[model samples]
Target: MRLFGTPTSLKRMVPRGLLGRSLLILVVPLVVLQVVTSVVFYERHWDTVMRRLASGLAGDIAATLSLLHRYPDPDGQAWVTDFAQEHFELQLDFKAGEVLPNDEHFRDALSEELNDSQNENMEDVLAQSLSERLHRPVMVDMAIFARDIDIYVQRSDGILHITAPRKRLFSSTTYIFVLWMAGTAMLLFGIATIFMSNQVRSIRRLAVSADGFGKGRDLPPIKVEGAREVRQAAQAFNLMRERIQRQVAQRTEMLAGVSHDLRTPLTRMKLQLAMMGDSPDACDLSEDVAEMERMVEGYLAFARGEGTESASDVDLVEVLETVVARFQRDERCAVELIGLYTASGERRQAPTTVRRDSIERCLSNLIGNACRYGQRVRVHYIAQEDEESCSIVVEDNGPGIPPVLREDVFRPFFRADSSRNSQTGGTGLGLTIARDAARVHGGDILLDDSQEMGGLRVTLHLPL
Candidate 1:
């Protein structure tokens, strides 16, 4: 239900988490792409790089041993060891038995003791353990044929036949590639955030401007920006607003002219009727003139209030109470005040204030119309359960309005078959005036078949 020409609903389709939603849409895909690409590259290429580096180190160690064998020279072996250490921190360990030489210094320190017969048995035990653990042949620190020479790589794991180096022979270009991919992803994410923000901001501006226009303010024309669709929508809204404003202005002018023209004849008729001398028909003439004047005035009032008015904050509950009170006073009808309501889980009162005077008049008209048409009128003032609005229901137990006439009852100069020619006279403008007032407040009046009373029920709803 509405006050006069108001929409009963105020809802928007856009979700509250629009920005977060957009960011998620953008960010999730980028992250997934990076993860997938990195995994695939690591498996297909990175493992191969590690294996090649291991093989190259093995080959380098083999060549060094061969060179030492050819020269039987400590200087050459030392030179090769120094070169390997400088490049990849390779430590040359000669595994004799379980007791491997720790380094060159340890080898020299224990040489004499190592040559004893008892030490030879200890060496045999070490060599047996080293041969089994290394899973391959190993060289001992002795003349190539004099002692089993085992050059085992020294590492966290006791000794391995294969050499371990500090760094792998992986391409520097691969690191650069990964960094570039990360940089590109971040850049895209930033660009997407910017674009989405701009789009949403444009929509926000459009919404604000529309709100201004709805309030009857002359909002500055919106500048189209952002995505093409959004810009187009803004342009369309501007054009539509202009068109609506022009139509409203034209309608106002037409109503003003028509009302003026109608009143001229009514005025003329009243003046002529007043000029008549005192007679039996004079009373009838005055009544007819009065009714006509009332109708014309009502039409003008309804049109003016509904079209030109702007809404303001109105305490809808208070407005209903006031209107119902006035109705009770004027017609001496009993009105019931139902419970006050709070909306959205808040204890605070919900007040819907808009065009106050217009809404009051509309309520009065509806209630008064009911009183005239029905006996035992029950006027109820209750806030709507829905958080969006409040309601006023005026119900009566009379011979209800016919279904055929219900739709047309709100038009100006329209009266039901049970009303227009009745002994109880009316100007046939009550419902029209009420509906107009409803529209002005951004609400509406609805006629329903009263289930409890088995008569007419008129409901008025105004938004909070």
Candidate 2:
């Protein structure tokens, strides 16, 4: 997520791409469940609240009607008027057959109920509740029934009345239902997007960092957080990376020490050999000592990873050309450079730049091996079918090596038949060093049958 600095953060969110896939498995179903739950919960809650509100409203209306009927005196009327004024709007119109005695107190009570509340119709809520209770459509509007009681509304100077024998009150269910639904949905969505994205992102970071570590890149140590399981995974990955790095460092140091110590004996041997002189066999002994020196130097250089860190941009074409030229100078070996060009048909193009000296050494080892074991050798530098890398192929015309021995050829100090044959020089470290160099450059060399040349084919590939 850090955008401006190193590529450390810009690496893909998951190492194997499965972390994002796993998150999708977890989150997609959860989101769907939440949505379904929200809808079902809202509807169920609305029904329960609406039913309760309807019962309360019906009871209140019946109780108010009873209080009005029983208390027909002025004090009673005054109390009724006070109740209506505080709670709702109502009207009382005495029928001729059921007349109330005309009194100032009763008149004041009637007047109070008339002037109490703002006159907006509650017909819609009442009708909806009625419809739900009856399980059939019901319409309520401003109207008066029997003249004894007038339940009506007046707005904008227009009197609207509702007079039903069975009174109804407005249900409060709609307010509660809407509020609950809106709140639940907002909460669910917020938790799903923000909280889940963060959890999934942390997991993705851990996976990607593990991948980068495997590929020999330094990933920032994972800082574990979030849910318990995710944190555990991150912590485990960090520990594994540290362990592997330490082991690799130890191995590299051990190799460095071994290479350094070998040089001291080699130096001493050189001095001892230089002193041998004035004999008929001295010339042959000196040549043998010189060969021993070359072998020792090669072993030391190969063991040290060529005295360089695993980095450097090598011009691959120059490496191939230089190796071929070196063998060309050795007229005893017939080395031919085949069509070694980029896929783009650019004659002077090199497909990759890697550790220069290491790549050159790898090429030289392959060509030298071919010359020693086969009659003719040809080297090719070109792109492969995948179009993402370059391959170097060294093939020859002699009888090919057995398939079983091909794999063994890359082992350090592994010679095919016996101790340094006439076909191969001293110290069987050539293929091992070559393979290691290719690996350090994020490439590899593979041995196969040379179908065209009827011998061994060694292909070295490096990433673009």
Candidate 3:
């Protein structure tokens, strides 16, 4: 059942990192247990102890009063005072003419502010106990002196002022109990933090290794040094990496052999067609052979996405400028770079680790396709520092693919242009190859309508 806030709001309040959440799990219960223990101790054990201490002090005072009443003469009263002070450790003083002050006056003259609720409770308990025993108005102030409690009792003659040691009513065990609880809690929390950090370190290493691997960066196997579950995950990741590498190696080797074999026949056909040039049938046959060769090349490029290229730290803006420059040389279409500068008008650089060849090829395909379909193409580079990513958007003012076919156009040999015209499109593998290159580096290509250009917009997003 939902309680305080909506589920979404509660989720936002929760810690996003595993370590923070784990520590919270440990701390919350420890805090709750300590709170409950303190409440129970104060409610039952501590309260009972305070009451007993107050009652004992009140009994001593009542007994002293009784002795004073018995010996009303001056010499007798002085002896009783000496006896009470020696036996009960109380300093007694008598005022024959002075009457007990009113509540407000007494509070102003004798009471001092207490530091905590415990002292206030102690004062209340002692005052209630004295009033019950002496059958007279009484005022108790613990804060009047550092080590003494000032208690005033109203009598018919005057007032009996008693000075008792603060230790008689205040328990030292309360502070000891609280300090012990806090010290132990802090000790346990520190221990848990150390152990939790060790466990989280292993998980963090695994996550970083996995992210690098996905981005096509080679990394050594991670050390499995955490709990059983974390160790198992690291083991699984290592095994998966080995299996995928083996499969890719096998596929590349097989395709290499096929490419070599197919090129020989195509080369012979091209030479044969050159010898029989100018004949209509030979020219038609040469065109067919060339089409076959184009299709074969497209298939190989698609299968060998990134091939064996190593990733390196490259400036993405430099790569985009190179591609744009190449397209600019072509008079068939006009291309422009929109975002090569920061908002402050200084030149910007996007430095990230990526396969340079793969990214270049991907950009070539996307821009080449746009230039082919439209007269003007605009390339926008958006660096999203907060997201730890960047995007290269290629927009063209061409008749964009319909919403339904945008996804289908990414399939190999599936062209939006149904005419199968070689002048318009080649083997329908351009988008497929571009997407594969992007995905090889743990990025993706997305197609949407361009708000500015009113045509197709292709955004290639890559992690920095």
Best by TM-score: 3
TM-score order of candidates, top first? 3, 1, 2
In the range 340-423, model 1's lDDT, one tens digit per residue, is 534555433565546666777787788777777665678765655577776778888866777777768777767555643253
lDDT of 3: 0.86
On a 0 to 1 TM-score scale, where does candidate 2 land against the true structure? Answer: 0.54
TM-score for every candidate vs. truth? 0.64, 0.54, 0.90
* Model 2: per-residue Cα lDDT over 168-274, one tens digit each: 33235556655776677667666666776778788878877765454345457988987899999998988887887677677678877877787777677667766
Query: Least lDDT summed over 10 consecutive residues: which range in candidate 3?
Result: 107-116
Instruction: Give the Å error, residue 351, model 3.
Output: 1.9
- By lDDT, the better pick of 2 and 3 is 3
Question: Considering every candidate listed, which one attains the maximal lDDT?
Answer: 3
**How much is the lDDT of residue 61 in candidate 3?**
97
What residue pairs are clashing in model 3? Answer: none
Worst 10 residues of 2 by lDDT: 108-117
